[model samples]
Target: MKATDRTPADLLRSALSEDPARPLVTFYDDETGERVELSVATFANWVAKTANLLQGEMSAEPGERVALLLPAHWQTAVWLLACSSVGVVADVGGDPAAADHVVAGPGRFEDGLACSGERIALSLAPLGRRFPTPPAGYADYAVEVPSQGDRFAPYAPVDPEECALIVAGAAYTGAEVVEQARADAPGLDLTGPGSRILSALPYDTWDGLAAGLYAPLAAGGSVVLCRNAGLLDDDALARRIESERVTATAR
Candidate 1:
């Protein structure tokens, strides 16, 4: 039998061990004309720090729910993995009042307040920089994440069969997500370190999460994530594909 990848973090370990310097996630904002690329080790560092922030700064515990209020950007992906690392269930667009925390982008900062709990805001700026001025009622992820330790050892090992992702109508365990992504990769022609998938899919849905987030990580491939891709012209898209060495696109 083929070895089963147990959890979302398991893929990160393989990617990090295989090629720490390889590009793991490349993010683009067509509307803002912003681009950011992160290698495996760099991405892992961000994950570690964010994981620590979730467990330490936010006081998030295993089995707690966190509503994800961001877009399909790279930072959002980091949060998904961070929650998984700490065994926090990531609720994408789920009810906020029912959650222990809410992570929102600037666009929805006010809307996010409707949910009563710890609020973390992302300026969503290039390089995940801090807001020049912090939001009054929210913790600035950019500022706090950097202060966290680079190395992260989860308080305890996460159970693979536990709920990890919550979406519109369904919830998936960490093992289910990993297994499905591993199964879906070959159909997408993604298999190994050389794969580079440029996905324009919005992350609010399970399909988008699979194509743009989990699949690449599972296959040891990289993702070129695009938000506001509809605004980009054909020439812009072509250039992105070429410059980023994108081997596939979920157009």
Candidate 2:
């Protein structure tokens, strides 16, 4: 971690400054045979827009909780960093009723209605296409976020000691989360920058978060995130590992 890095947002900014052209996240949906790669700049742009949407449109204040009912897709990774940038506590798989806001994918639209606050839905489609018909009482994230400012400046500064994420009923402050990511990186065999780690783990636990997103970012590496990887035949999986140049895996 850089000397100036105290939060995950700082890590992202550092990554962007260091290598904007390098692939930051490579996403694959083996179930759909879809693949998308986002460079550091591109991913950061998405994060900025999403952060703007959360802060301005959703009226999410610093320290507020946002329930994330999504999978381990690239967009989910964007939302995680977006929440961090704006100081909103990202609660993964958290109860909708308890959140100040909710971001849900198509599969969790009905459940997201439990959030009395602002609710947003993602189509999770290829190229982030909007839903055929928008869900009732929910703002379409794909539609709304695009119009949000490409650059974001948080209205309030994020406190590293403040709670930034909640996973599996355990809360982790911003600093602690960064610390955990750095600690996990070596054990996960993340060999510093440029290490391409492929992860098939779901984003519902600290271990999964460390492998699929945080550790790679903290280690100045990148991740190949695969969804429904179990569906891939052994031959196909082997080909993917070889083609993607996977150095390690967290499955």
Candidate 3:
């Protein structure tokens, strides 16, 4: 399938069925010179565990709002799918005061503490390590997620028409997100299967989320998500392209 147009959860299932070993997301941190690659199965495992924590531990349900305060990182991507699986709204960079749940990285821990209720913190550290101890009030994501079951079966139905994403003052239903990606794919020139894309666009904007996250996944391709892309010199960028076999780039 060149592109599977559906909800994020369905896209993941389709990708896994086609090829579990296929590289789904390659993450790079130019400033830290760190590299991590996740296959379809591996990424799905992360999603399931996180979803379990959200649905079972945090009591996340349909219509609940999750304020995502993390930056453009692999874990952030995992949260996007996790929320979709549990049928919670992913409010990216949303107002914490208005949220039911909050996921923050080390950088935003202080501000996230003021959120309405429920708090999860990601170290965003290498290998997803836990904080030394739980934060003042927030639960350490790394500490809690590991104990959750590997399998995920949502207790309630997740309607495709329900709002799954709310970002930058725009709301998108689960179906709308998939449809939008399909509509924008041709214009973005994302053609054929196994196309690898390197993207530096931040995920806070609609186009940024489309190009960096959705478009490639919709096209049955993969994404090389880069944080601190501006730090990479031309030679380094070219080297990454050659090494990762990247087919396209958006910065």
Candidate 4:
């Protein structure tokens, strides 16, 4: 489908309505060694709620940038989808300084462009605790906005030509590569609802975001996102492929 045809929110809405009970996310946490499953309905609601929070609580307007310095997790997925649903530009990158508003993990990096002045600090891990109070003009995430239920109306219409995600790298070089890569991606045999994709790439990369997430989701297939590519030997990967009946994979 063309980018201009429909927004990300449209795709999400369709997914939720078509199969509300279907598993939208299967997260494997290495820390606790646990697997958590989230259904389409639940994920959609979380996205809506997060979007509503961004709008009502944070006073974020459509098209404004929200920087996410998070790893691959359910929360990250919800944040990305929520930004898309509300027409807010989501900048997914390693450097939080590039974004006007920053959401970051605690104790990572405090002094930066984003942290300099009146910036917002949003904590995702602790969930309810607030800490590391901004020096002066800054505001805490929870204090600034009131918590509300996860309920949001769909966006009317959004222009897809506008930038949705921005990755960090040398501008000219990466932009050309990204254009070429996006063109090359569709040519792959990425069809089949039962097909499974195994991706070792990070979520921030174009290939990771497109093929690992968007492509499979668009094609009605499943994806397995691996945290450490180095740890997965050929034998292990092959075993997973066989066990899961994975039909396709991205090296």
lDDT tens digits, residue span 55-123, model 1: 998889889999998889999999999998899999998777788899999778877787687899999
- Top of the candidates by lDDT: 2
RMSD of each: 1.6, 0.8, 1.5, 5.0
User: Least accurate stretch of 10 residues (summed lDDT) in model 2?
Assistant: 1-10
For lDDT, candidate 2 versus 3, the one ahead is 2
User: What is the Å distance of residue 226 in model 1 from its true position?
Assistant: 1.0
CA displacement after TM-score superposition, residue 19 of candidate 3 (Å): 0.8
Q: Give the poorly placed runs of model 1, Cα more than 4 Å off.
A: 1-4
Cα error, candidate 1, residue 187 (Å): 2.2
lDDT of 1 at 225: 93
How do the predictions measure up, each by TM-score? Answer: 0.95, 0.98, 0.96, 0.73
Query: CA lDDT of 116 in candidate 4?
Result: 36
State the displacement of the C-alpha of residue 158, model 4, in Å, after optimal TM-score superposition: 3.1
Better by lDDT, candidate 4 or 2: 2
**How far out, in Å, is residue 159 in model 2?**
0.4
Q: Model 3: per-residue lDDT, tens digit, 1-251?
A: 42433588878878888898999889988877778999989999999999999998999889899999988888998999999898999999998889999999877888898797899999887788788887777999988988888889999888889999998999999989888877776666678577888989888988888877777778888889999989989999999999999888889
- Give Cα distance to truth, residue 227, candidate 3, Å: 0.3
In model 1, residue pairs whose N, Cα or C atoms come closer than 3 Å (at least 3 residues apart or on different chains), thus clashing, are none
lDDT of each: 0.88, 0.93, 0.87, 0.59
Weakest ten-residue segment in model 3 by summed lDDT: 1-10
- For model 3 the TM-score comes to 0.96
